[model samples]
Target: MDYAKTERADALAAGYVAGTLRGPARRRFEALLPGHPALRAAVRDWQDRLMPLTASLPPVAPPPHVWAAVERQLWPTVAAAAPSPWWQRLAPWRALSGLALVAVVGLSVLLATPPPAQAPVVVVLQSTGKDPAVAGSLVASFSGDGRAVVARPITPVAVTTDRALELWWAPLEGKPTSLGLIRADGVTVLSRGRLPGGLRGSGIDHMAVSVEPPGGSPTGQPTGPVVFYGKLQL
Candidate 1:
């Protein structure tokens, strides 16, 4: 196959960025990347497109037990030493608990504040195939203000290097409208300008994903099988 071809390089780069191109295929792609400027450019483009999605997501703090477990693994002698006095052990825990309490209170205050007129909508796109790599669901969340949407896969989807995944908004009566190309194994954020207006109305029915040639369907309609779909509930 001609890896230098724009479509071919883009498809391979998309799979690599999404983490679906793995094992020997992944290694080969990496080895070829340095020799192929087209492949490198494709990869850079994909990274720029997908990496920004993380900026909108809030960070999650790991639980206290996880840190304790890491400390035990790294410092066995200290961890295995005779248990510290009850007060000594409790002291550090107390401080952590206090900080957690403050955070909870702040979050509660935020949640108690008045919300936007439109509530956020969540849709779960179920896989049509039984293949283990594509069995899990994809979650699409529409912001309460209807200004943006974020879609994330629950598991990495195994797709060929010659294919890409395309997202669609399938209305109740009309044909599906292409949202954009999406990574099979990563988060995709669509701004309001990219989404069709009035998505919360009855005209909005389902969100779907279809396989397509790299760079998406050229005819402006799905050319391959629809692999995942879910009803949109507002």
Candidate 2:
């Protein structure tokens, strides 16, 4: 959609940050973010601007219908059994109150924890020649929703000011796509939509990293030798 070039980018980014964008639309918007720094910056700005308002709001009990909607989201099978309005007496909101408590607790846990690192599918990247166990070992994992990928270094890997470490995904059958540039020590989170088809399911064959001119490869293709390579696993 070339959302990066359009006015809708701001609006879409706002919705994405607000937790209002959902399903495929949300995923699609996330996919667009990597190539557009301005959109990513706008989203970060919105998040910074909105978080305080969100935190300041008083917690209120949700209306009954809201619980119904949540049930539908959390348990579609349970929701479909009645096929009637949840307000109906026979629908038994009383009995479901206990289930609601469980739901609430579950939701709280989900909210309190970081999403990506929780039992994340991992890829272990190893550099060639030297001990694979030594410096330059990296771990790659995905967010619970598969909307982001995090790469964390287990050991040091050097990069000069004129160069950067760039990550890439090689799908089973297509050209590699840049995930993003990452740091050597700290964690780098790449917010993205669902991975390319080749990289998802069983289509992902490998992941690789290369040293590139500062900022990243300019031609959208790796211009330097791959320094680390790994088989991607879910």
Candidate 3:
């Protein structure tokens, strides 16, 4: 592959930075970066473009068990202390009441069920603005079964109370269709019932997020500026 080509490099770098290029493909891209200056430049450009999206995200502390596991790996001898008695460790169980225990069991059963045969499709919607402070990004994942989609903001988006963020499925040759109104600060799930048919087909060209009224576009089309947009890889 000619990594020097701008179009090819940009596409691969975008996927790499967005975390959609994974496993062997990701490793292969990294290996080529050292030998290809254009590829390296593309990667740097993408990092600069997408890194700002994390500015509004608050720091999250890891769980206690995660730290404990790290400490065990770092100092095995120190972590080999005697296990506490069952009664002494009751504190953890106290948080899991009878109802919670039943819920956990039900979740375990659900998890044991087989996953969808197809792999999920992931898209990274990048901000269209040049300013980092005002720009935002979002990651959207379509379930393998094509029955649902989960949209999550990379950072909190500031919007007036009267305005809202809306997702759209833009086709190759026509006006975009509204997927649904999405949140600016949290994950939003759109079920199959909420979505129109032919999502898994080739009719759709790309996905976009547009700023709109609180209840979404009154005209069944985007009324506000398109703040973020991305191409569909499917």
Candidate 4:
């Protein structure tokens, strides 16, 4: 096939290596990998190219069972000719508690859980100054029954003027995605309907507050320094 289509196939190649390729696209790539050695090389090349982006990532050692699960998937049909790193055995999903649920109830389940309880306890994310003066304070609370979190900005934050703060939960080891932009009294409450399996109770390893751009970080990845990082405890 043509590896030079649509800007020289870099995007497609990235998606393929990232396992985001699906349906006919993935099937075509799989079939192509065996017969067209160059295509195989391209897949490997792309994976190698992006491997470092995730490196220097202060390794998030998966649970002991993670490697076993990985080997289970890999040992079935092994390839001896490849030269790949141990990390290559990893899948980004295994790192997220949502993976197990995604495999089971699927993404739709994120919307299916029951309603919140009546005894909700409020948790707030305050600005770095730790002054509690209410400039960039964001607040959220658990449903009285503790099924989900109601999160929202308490104020309007302009990155240039009022330091932008983003909220994140360690669904696993690292937190990705914005809970949403926050500021004092901006968004009264954001109801977290269902916490990913990873972030439930002590299940949540950690929670963080980041200083970000006005609208929030452009890249899905975090661009700002962590302002506050604390473990989730009972």
Q: lDDT: which candidate is best?
A: 3
Of 1 and 4, the candidate ranking higher by lDDT: 1
By summed lDDT, which 10 consecutive residues of candidate 1 come out lowest?
A: 130-139
lDDT for each residue of candidate 3 in 1-234, tens digit (9 for 90 to 100): 778897678778879987878899999999998999998898898788556545444555676889999998998887888486455566656745755886999799889965434555667887877333345678776765555788888656777788898998877899888889998888898757444554565367788888888899999998888888888766
lDDT of 4 at 33: 64
Q: How far is candidate 1 from the true structure (C-alpha RMSD, Å)?
A: 12.3
Backbone clashes under 3 angstroms, per model: 0, 0, 0, 13
What C-alpha lDDT values do all the predictions have? 0.74, 0.69, 0.76, 0.53
In model 1, what lDDT does residue 191 have? 57
Ordered list by lDDT, greatest first: 3, 1, 2, 4
Q: Which 10-residue window of candidate 2 scores lowest in summed lDDT?
A: 128-137
List the candidates ranked by TM-score, beginning with the highest. 3, 1, 2, 4
After superposition, candidate 4 runs with Cα above 4 Å error: 1-118, 124-139, 145-148, 151-159, 185-187, 191-194, 197-202
TM-score of each candidate? 0.48, 0.46, 0.53, 0.36
Q: List the pairs of residues colliding in candidate 1.
A: none
Query: What would you estimate as the lDDT of candidate 4?
Result: 0.53
CA deviation > 4 Å runs, candidate 3: 1-14, 17-29, 32-116, 130-134
